[model samples]
Target: MNVLKCFNKGQPLPLRIKAADALRYLCSYDPVSQDIRTKITVIMAELLVLSNDNEFDLINEIMDDFVLKYAKELEPFALQLAKNLNIQFLRIAEELMNFSTTQNNDDKVSKEQLDKEYQASSILTNMNTMIITMTSEKDLTYALLGSVEPSIRFVLENCMANFISELMEILESFNYTMKCIVPEAWSIFDLVCESFDNFGFDYVLDYLQYFESIITYSFLEDGNKAGSNNDINAGQKTEEQKTSIKNEESKIISLVVKLLNEDNGENFADEDLVLFLFKLISLLVLKLGCVNF
Candidate 1:
């Protein structure tokens, strides 16, 4: 599809509507071939260029259209793409920093060119916002987890690990960006945790470190504190938010404790998995001196 022709500088509205329809079609339907995916990717690339247009209401319209139409089908793709693009943003930010340091010494590139590059980065970053919403989508999560793409499982696992590592590594540099992205990241974690039941505890254990890294990182950023109600500032956060974070902390700790306690190389029996989790939860409850589900 000639996405360039779909956009007109002189006549924008009709072309914008057509482009939005084309995008929605590309995202929602199963592609007939790899060529279609490539085409859609190119269209997405073009759409990214228009991110800064003053008349971007059509872009919002298309984003909402895709969200409504493929809330399930396109969400995992969008989520992963969003995460991947966000990682790009982090890398680009580092590049920008390096450029700023050297550009002060060089005079070859003009200010306008540097400004264009910065603007391009900002546009890509804003395009990533749509991805954050997809990650938080509840129905989409359920659909992605339930998807049985046996052929793509290995690819998906690798992509997930790489994406998670990239996100964790540069999280400090992009704290505010991550703050906006965290809820969706947690939604992903929730799905990964659920995978324990279907895929087995061992599978979940394989990725638990990444999960803990996110928790620890967020906790550190949020003042490296957990459940310290005694501190005056700690009381400022809502009890629900605190409890939720605590629950996640408890879950991770419980899983780690189970792995350590059952240090035998064999996977735990299904019954054992349940009993282990129950005991761990009980121990945490007792240690905290509170009973809350």
Candidate 2:
């Protein structure tokens, strides 16, 4: 408790590490009481919210280790921890997964690659560990997929469907398809809505606008990805990849159509939504070549 208090009250890095190490030792070696375990979980969850580099790295290490080894004993407090921290961990993971795409062979490797890549590469590198915890321990089979952000999900629904076709057309010059390990968009849209229930119709409006950014990044006609060493290659498009992408997009379009059909303009009733709506419409016209209605 003293260690935790000192750490939480803003101890120096060494002190914080010392205290955190002590906590780790107690949780692993000593048979801490249930109350202590509960308290520890709450602290760990809170540290994730803190999201400082040191704190997040330490707590992620602790929970990732403890959650699996002591799964049977740790469920109650783990749930509280997961609930309190909620989606933040997943967001970190998604950001990490998406991080790979931001660079390509053509991009000059920076001296600060370690710091720049650490955030995402850490999760991607440790994914096997995370998958084991998620599947065997936490019972969330597709939690990573479930946790992918709305913007990325939008890209997946479009890019992955026409993935091969789109890649052949837009990214054939590119050597890297760093956008792997994605999930279907339709399933995630429901969850996205659930996740942002507090924001109501405005969330939908914002996301539609966010889709425009994806449009700009994805559909370049010159076949030059800003960060990639894309070499020309059309023969790489596999029939199976195309088929899978089509199926995923087909489902996503259902929801898209539903939203389009449902919008009789009242949902944009908020004065604030007009700017977003107009921007989105312009993006659709400029990027997608949609006929202006």
Candidate 3:
């Protein structure tokens, strides 16, 4: 509670920063009693409401991480926070996605690279923490999906996609750059997948269309790639470009195959889900020649 005083208008910038950091540390290590959590939420909300741009960003960072760390303690109020801080939260999501294992020409990590990775890791820390809370409350997952901001929804949905699209991007970049995928990031993805799968057919059905959109990326016919000179690439693909596209396609197939191996729809899910998986699997086999049984 003393940390809350650092938000006073007369507080020194350094003091305020230190106080906020100290509170965040305390919040993460200790399970905040419900009463203290309520006070902190109310205080943080007020600070956000009254802050200028500089103060807003600072306080947002503090409260955002707090919410992420004690997500179970704070999630009951996440929707309210999202509503009030929609743009900042969306920007947070965008920043998290903007992280790349893709380095510049020479495969070396620079100061800028380190800073970006730190920023991304910080954001992902909060996100992964929230995902831990979300995994326990299926309804929280749906609530986040219904966020008024589309980017918020994007974060929630993509967080649950078993990292198929995300891991592909990471793997492609990693393979190209001799980079490594963060093991913790992969574990968060796996946890979300396993948590949702525990919902069985209901989870499958609820997210069916969204999953289909991701799966269809590797299934684009030749006609889909055939376009005029006005398109983004502007003209024909070079050999390297063609190889890159093929490599991406292979990544997509590998991702789908991996997902299927984890998802045994026929055994425990609805028959319709089983049939849908079969049909999708058949198309995949026809395109790729075979899949791992």
Candidate 4:
């Protein structure tokens, strides 16, 4: 359809729209013939240019809608594309994240470019979603306790580790904000704790500091939800369930202790370090009360 020419030559709006449509159709439906792949690659490269140039709102808009609708198909495709493309997708993600931090409206691209960026972003977000789903699907808690696949082992491990690192960075930033700007540090602490309560084991504990500090930190009482009438044990636990939970708790606690020791108690100040130590000890004590102990 001479789509590449339209994008390369920066032709009229209708040509660009038609080019995007043709590219999307060929990539999704056409058999992956040599010509198809070349066309798709060219179209993708052109879209990437538009993404960077901040031109052509239609390109971004169409890409955004296409990616969201086809996320399940696009995710692995994007990952493969990341491996093959001259420019790395992760680097783009990092750049986008950086852009998000600086000028609020700085990365404003044309509708065309925005669609392209949205498609790319949807792929990454899908990976995050898939990781969570896989955990529940095959009961990955059982599989990943020791280790997992060779193909995905490092990538999944890295993904989780990176997420944990990012989460910890957020927590630290929140702490700083609380100390400098907010009335109370409790807001930061509580938010961190809530995240812990919700997504505890999803994080891969790689760094000693985060592993020890948050992953292994004692499950502090949630004051806000303390008296809420929600059913904590709606699903009755079997003996196996109890055992699994206890073991998971023990492993997490051990990981934390290891991390804390690795830091030599130097990361935090003396008073805060003592409080952390106290929390660690309390967690150990709580573990001792469990059936496994």
How much lDDT does each candidate structure score? 0.43, 0.42, 0.47, 0.40
Off by over 4 Å in 4: 2-8, 12-14, 26-38, 55-80, 83-120, 123-293
Question: Per-residue lDDT for 54-173 in model 2, tens only?
Answer: 424444565555555554444444434444333443454344345456645543443233343343323222222333344332224234333323333433333322112221211111
Residue lDDT tens for model 4, 193-250: 4444444434433222332333232222332111212232223446674554444445
TM-score of 3: 0.39
TM-score of each: 0.30, 0.37, 0.39, 0.30
Runs in model 3 deviating more than 4 A are 27-35, 46-52, 55-61, 83-86, 89-128, 152-293
Which 10-residue window of candidate 2 scores lowest in summed lDDT?
Answer: 167-176
Q: Name the regions of candidate 1 deviating beyond 4 angstroms.
A: 1-181, 200-209, 220-235, 264-293
Candidate 2 TM-score, C-alpha based: 0.37
Candidate 3 lDDT, 1-293, residue by residue in tens: 66668855578867776776677666654454443575666656655554324423455466656665556656777666545454544554454455444545553445544443343333333333343454444445434434432432344465534223332332222212211112222333344344445543444444343333333433334433222222222355566755645554555356445556776555536665666566656766775576765
Q: Considering only N, C-alpha and C atoms within 3 Å, which residue pairs clash in candidate 1?
A: none
Whole-model alpha-carbon lDDT for candidate 4? 0.40
Instruction: Please provide the root mean square deviation of candidate 1 (C-alpha atoms, Å).
Output: 18.1
Clashes of 1: 0
Query: In model 2, which regions exceed 4 Å deviation?
Result: 33-36, 52-59, 70-112, 124-130, 134-139, 142-144, 149-293
Ranking by lDDT: 3, 1, 2, 4
lDDT of 1 by residue, 1-293 (tens): 46435654454766755755675665544553234444444444445445433334355445445444443444546644354334434444444545656675445455533653444334342333343344454344323222312212322332323223223222222222233224434455555555443444534434433443444334422533443332222434566766666666566565556555765755555555555455655654554565444
Of the candidates shown, which would achieve the greatest lDDT relative to the real structure?
3
